[model samples]
Target: MTGTGAALTYTTIAGRHRHEIEVRRSRFIAVLERVESQEQADALLAALRREFHDARHHCSAILIGANREVQRANDDGEPSGTAGAPMLEALTRRETADGRTDLSDVAAVVVRYFGGILLGAGGLVRAYSGSVSQALDTAQYVQRERCGVFQVSAPHATAGRLENDLRGAGLTVRGTTYQPSQVLITVAVADSSAELEVFRERLAGMTAGAADAAHVGCEWVDRV
Candidate 1:
């Protein structure tokens, strides 16, 4: 439990959320959506542009990867750093209502309907950042953590009890499968090697060494 797995927790919006604000007669509509990949982010931006073709600018930003290692932003014709940069900053700085921080796998697009009152570069920055912050206020999210995966095999009679014990021991049972002579249980666990060793001991004690789990892979799992 001493690596990134123990140190980082990512925040992700659960679905599409939006906020609209009027500043000096200009309308800024911010749309925030959870996107798993760059392609999806671009597609969503394209759709928003077409959907709001009447808008003057479609400023956008995308944060991808579990660690948010991938990020892309575009002013989309707004002055450099005035629109997209602020929007991205607002997202990266703010946290969800549930308190998760460092938002990732998110795409934010702000469609501006110019009010004819030029909101100079400074004003644009404030408007865009505020627009995203407002949308985040109404968004729902779950915290995500990376976990190692394992598959445990057990006799049919011992499977149910083992599963209950696993859950009781704070392991995430991904799924279960029944075979002709045994049952397979997939579990996702945190990164503590000590905890893993303890789990093996628990398995031995529960089934008298007749059942055990095999390390498989890893994935990002979400929880409230």
Candidate 2:
């Protein structure tokens, strides 16, 4: 979580723990899920609230981007820093599931229902933090890759052959557009100029120099 050059791997905690930490008749239920961005975190939080509509508190926190650039936490009316901050910290300390030395964009949400026991400020922190920790223990994660988009254009007659060739060569096809005489194919490749050149050569040869490929912008894609 501290380095600047390491690739990000997604991971969670290893086991589950659920205990009623005293907090003025309220019990915490932490839910952790890997997310790609703040928008996804927001959507999940909204869904959880709706699913558990009668719960008393739905506090949440999210850390996203390669550098963990995007971060947000909400106390949801808990005693100031008691709910959100601790949850964020727990996520930060938790290692990715793959055992890779990479950081990831992740989010965790903790829900609390009043249980009639007062856990005080320290206890509140423990309860909220513990909830996310437990959920992380059982969650699944995958690594994401940052790639570049490329488009290739060829005649309709050669489209099927071109598509099959590209897939056989291990290039990911994002989309394909059909025209009366040609087919436009969109693909994603690793963000390396060398790889692009290789792709071009292979594609040109496959289509007998009848097809030409162009580079588009870069995109963050899920690594398969």
Candidate 3:
């Protein structure tokens, strides 16, 4: 599996359970959602807040992008590290919410409304973290693939045939561009150099050595 050219799905813990702990005069509700970007994370948080708008505070934390490019968290009003940090830690625990695995780049938000019970600082940490654990109890997750991007170009006359052949060979076409005399096709191959050789040979044969292809960068793509 290490060098087989197959994309590795990240392993996460499995099970479904929720934990609840009380905080200082507030009850926090944490919901965890696996997301791909800051925008998607924000959208999920917004939706959760709208559903529980009357709550006192809506603290959030998000980690997104293939490289975990964007990471942010807010305490809302609970003492600096009491709310968001704990919630983020809960989400990053590499555990399955349900029975699935391969979780990455996710966001976790904790919503609080005064419960009229002072749970103190220790309680706040436990409560905020517990909320996220609760939401994961029923969440679903899927594996993702890291792919290598490539671009192939050929004369317009051979474009259609080349495209059909590539598809039949199980290559994922990312995008296509048509120019005056040639067609450009962008594709994503599995993340191994060996796979690129196989693709290059097949494409070359399909186009009778007239078409040329080049490699682009690698990107994380949704697994089928």
Per residue, candidate 2 scores C-alpha lDDT tens digits across 1-224 of 12357443343222222333334667677766667767878888998899878888899888777667777889998899998999888777776744543445777778789887777889888888887776666565556666678888888887887888899999988999998877899988876667778887888789788777777776766666
Stretches of candidate 3 exceeding 4 Å from the true structure: 1-27, 31-53, 96-103
Local error of candidate 1 at residue 168 (angstroms):
3.9
Local distance difference test values of all predictions, in order:
0.87, 0.74, 0.71
Q: How many residue pairs clash in each candidate?
A: 0, 15, 3
Question: What residue runs in model 1 are displaced by over 4 Å at the alpha carbon?
Answer: 1-8, 96-101
Candidate order by lDDT, highest to lowest?
Answer: 1, 2, 3
TM-score of 1: 0.88
Q: Report clash pairs, candidate 1.
A: none
Query: For model 2, how many clashes?
Result: 15
The 10-residue segment with the lowest total lDDT in model 1: 1-10
TM-score (C-alpha) between model 3 and the true structure = 0.71
| Full-model lDDT, candidate 2 | 0.74
Model 2 residue 5 lDDT? 70
Clashes of 3: 3
- Name the best candidate (by TM-score): 1
Clashes (candidate 1) = 0
